[model samples]
Target: MKKKKYNTLWLSFLGVTAIPVLAIFIITMVVARNEFYEMRAIYGPNFIPATRESILMILIFVAGLILVANSLWMIWMKGMVIKPLRDIEAAAKRIAKGDLEFTIVTQRTDEIGELCRDFEEMRRQLKASQDARIYTEQQQKMFISNICHDLKTPITSIQGYVEGIMDGVATTPEMHSKYLKTIHNKANEMNLLINELTMYNKLDMDHVPYDFKEVNLKKYIDDCAEDLEDELATRGVNFGYRYNCADDVTVKVDPVQFSKVIHNLIGNSVKYMDKEDKRIDLRVKDYGNSVMLEIEDNGMGISEKDLPRICDRFYRGDSSRGKTKGSGIGLSIVKKIVGDHGGQISATSKVGLGTTMHVILKKSAGGKNG
Candidate 1:
């Protein structure tokens, strides 16, 4: 559409400029013809005008033609070239001044129009990059604030416990032992926070090493669930597993990192248990070329708004913040580990019911469970 408009402008310019030149040419031709006829009648058939007069007339005619043409050419250039160039120059100046909102509007079909289009595209890209940078900086600030706040709680607890022991407040052996254990637990919590931060940085940098192997999916999940049995029991959470696959369904994955994924998810579920009947179900189901592993819990579920961002780094849901002790990067680490294994993870939850985490992994090429 813009090209067509500019093409029409060019045609209009040519037509307007040609009309005056055509008129001048026609008037000159008519006057010259009339002068010749008059000369023939007054000075007989073979007569010609005096050389001086002829030269003067010819010079005047040529001068008038040149003057009219030059004026028309200047007008055409001003409208077609100078004005559009000035507009582009001004738009560039505005962009350099950080005014990205300015748009270069043009109806040119030539090189100038293309230049404007390219400039607009560049401006849009610059604005987008600026916005992304701003968002990242804000997120970084928030992450630091959250981490400091998280660390402070544990550090404060450890300090108080140590101070109590030093002041002889824990006089009894049992009291001393309890205070020491409490201090140890607070230190452990701080260590966990630091570990999460380190792991997140590794994941971001793609530096987390993996040792991939083919393992039976059913056995892997069963083992992982069994390992968590004692922990679940300690929290009064009933844990169960069901394998809906044939004997030898297998997938290639990094065992240690994959274990982390399982532990993080199960731990998250345990941390958020709000019901008396706390239960977690780990299930492995076989599809034709892939397996679906699920860890579902009857704990407090995520809100719809927070569910989408659960796997985002440093994103702690409002409900999860006061309810659990975490740096909010566990799910992000889990997500990254799963993604690195060429699998995908997702969560579905209702606020009051529970949250179900689903991991889908492609079956090993040699593993057939038929």
Candidate 2:
């Protein structure tokens, strides 16, 4: 039952209005009492006049009524302002008590309304941050689960083979050679996985520098084509390379990493050639300030869905060729190298058609000079 605080100006108005009525009532009573006394004196009648006590009594009655009426009016005016503030206070308390479900009912166009909007926005941001944290934690758990499964199989195979050799179970020379080969192969797989993990960690660091230089686009293309031509011919695949760029169409990039990129794309194409007429096409074009290179193949192309994630580290799609090569980090490394050179790379594929990778690199101001 807290008392309501009335506006000071409204209370003052009530006081001012009461003053005039009180003064008039007092003055009228005094004047009427005097006139009655004067009439009695002048007429010489025995009738008694109203005295001072009667005037006082009339004045008191009139002043009390005026005060009461003014008080009720002031109470009504104060209620208009108090109710909205009380509702806002209650809502705030509920929010403090962990009930953010309450909706504010403020139509005020003042500081209070602005404060309410800010509070709502802050709550929304906090909720989003909480959701993101939960999602990240779930992803971390899944990554660990997948890593365990991936590591356990290879280590178990290596252990089994090594133990058989140690127990003298491999009697013949061929059997011993076979066991040793199994052990060696498993060890190599483990080493490769560890290397991939290590390299990713290093790349995540802030200061790992890459070697960048101006590379002759045509010469590099020719070198890769020459090296892979014999291998492709042996596998009955026709590999065509065209370097339409100028002989000096140079771009600033890491040569070693770029070589790895070419090696991986060509190697993967040859590995997954399922058709009788397998073909791979490589081409480079000079577009003044930039150079674009494309590698396209008619092998077992990836699905439309997997094209988005093919460049992600360790993301092996269902369309993967037989388990014949590296730890599926080739495309990811290619993407990272391209990105380091301030370039862009993308892939397009159809289920039955083929896959094409396009890379664009900006030529640096440091032109190629021998």
Q: Estimate each model's TM-score.
A: 0.76, 0.61
What lDDT is reached at residue 122 by model 2?
A: 60
Error of 2 at 144 (Å): 2.7
The backbone clash count of each candidate, in order, is 0, 0
Misplaced by over 4 Å in model 1 are: 1-38, 41-95, 99-125
Residue 98, candidate 1: C-alpha displacement in angstroms: 3.6
lDDT of 2 by residue, 1-370 (tens): 9998777856686676777776777688678867877888897778666465777776777777777777776676556555555666676677668565556555667676666666667656655776767665764565466567667888898888888889998999999999989888878878876876666666656344778887777777788889878878888888888887767767777787677777777776776566788999988877668888888899778887788978876566666623544455667777777887898888887776677888888866764421
lDDT string for model 1 (1-370, tens) is 4553355445665676666656766786777778888999998999875654665576567767766776687688777877887787887888889888867776768997888788888988998998888777886788888888889998998899899999999999999999999999989888888988898999889998888999987778778878888778888889898888877878999998999998999988988889999999988887678888889998889999998998987788889776666777899899999999999999999887999999998999998954
Compared with the true structure, model 2 gives a TM-score of 0.61
lDDT of each model, Cα atoms only? 0.84, 0.73
Q: Give the clash total for candidate 2.
A: 0
Worst 10 residues of 2 by lDDT: 319-328
- Model 2, position 341: C-alpha lDDT score: 80
